[model samples]
Target: MSMNGREKITNKKRLKPAKIVWQVIVYLLLITGAIVMLIPFFWMLSTSLKESFQVFSFPPKWIPDPIKWDNYVLTFNSLPFGKWLVNTVIITASTIVGTLLSCTIVAYGFARFRARGRNVLFLVMLATMMLPSAVTMIPVFYLFKSLGWINTFYPLIVPAFFGNAFFIFLLRQFYMSIPTELEDAAKIDGLGTVGILWRIIVPLTMPALTTVAIFQFNGAWNDFMGPLLYLSKPDLYTLALGINFFKSQNDVQWNYLMAASLVTMLPSLILFFVGQKYFIEGISLSGGIKG
Candidate 1:
């Protein structure tokens, strides 16, 4: 009995150390992945503060001996940076508003109403999400050109009002999770369909709405191809298009470009961080829905 007890104690001690070793390994792997992901942002900051020559230096200096603050100022002065900033802001805001309102309404219809070909239409919408943007880009450009929306913000902002496939799907899932009893009760109180939707459904789905808004904001802010293809006038250029304008045939100012890129990313980053809590909750709630 004494020998059995000693053996059991020894085995317990050995298993504890093994578990601790596995935990340490996992922590090391997570930290390494985080550092790898952060490296590009660090490199951008380093290069943005370095001089033109130092940017191309061998061994890749991580720290600049003399930080050049002029790159940011020069970037703004060399292009219509202010105009680009305003254009991006307007497009992003408009897209967010349109996406939330239209997607929610469409999603509610698909989730609540049972009409002919509803399932087939929903599946078709889902299929569109799988289609590559490149396949439709040229056709969309020509369509917009015929409508005289080229060289204008209309092309950038108007399509968002039609609702996005993925966002509508997401909102539909959330709306399905909401109890039907609430809507039924509102109806008994003499509320119409639109009233129940506006008063009860929208309030309950605030987290999901916020999630859609954040995604739309990010998409509009980071969009490059649409702006490049549509907006020809220098005054209408967004930040994404303005970045291309900075790269001329003869001269490419890497430092200034990096500074401008960093500046362009700030708003999306701030918005994401601020709305992160709701975004997570919205995703979780949507995932819990049936069908």
Candidate 2:
């Protein structure tokens, strides 16, 4: 072989180790991060199975010796967890429905219609996002109180019937990405605007819609302040508020609290795992070019 060829082969062999080392370094960093993030969760799981006395044991037992699975059973027994779960589910479901319906219609109008002051209205809606919720919380609470919605599910679920700025933007962008030819075809077949939306646009936009649903589900499920502000009745308590009350007991049971938290967290984890594929795709598709 020529000397140049042998030199090239030697250089290639030398470069391979550097690439492997770089990859090894990256993997090590990622693994370290994963372990660091998981430690608190591991501690929670361990503490949940421990006896109340064992929770604060020195040096911190990473493993509960004789894992008391009954902690989970006791967690539900100590509170009205089932009723709280039902309340949360109802509020979350209503919020999702209202969000999807209002946002879709408003977004469809923004994406497809050419009306006066369209861009200005869009900007005004977007500007609302800049205003901190703290500024409006009291006024909104007063409005609900005036409407007799305080202590009722209406305060928790009714506001979502109005379009959310971010969700409208996300859905509008997704709508713009779709080709207009399909709508034209639907029109030629005598389908009206609502018909086109329901039959054509919605089916194509399932991924983005699912993303919105998941986002609202997470938000509504974990919300603390909304319920704290409007829901004065214990019978109307959602799981998040119920858990906060659990933490306030004069003699707090860390194990039971941890266990209840785990139960509260399980649905979100399961939903994310089930819909992660669409959630990611939807977000990517939502960043479409302006029409």
How do the residues 97-117 of candidate 2 rate in per-residue lDDT, one tens digit apiece?
A: 999999999999999999999
Q: What is the C-alpha RMSD of each candidate to the true structure, in Å?
A: 3.5, 3.1
Q: Pick the candidate with the highest lDDT.
A: 2
- TM-score on alpha carbons, each prediction: 0.89, 0.93
Give the alpha-carbon lDDT of every model: 0.89, 0.93
- Where model 2 places Cα greater than 4 Å from the true spot, the runs are 1-14, 279-291
For residue 146, give model 2's deviation from the true position in Å: 0.5
Provide the global lDDT of candidate 1 against the true structure. 0.89
Error of 1 at 88 (Å): 0.6
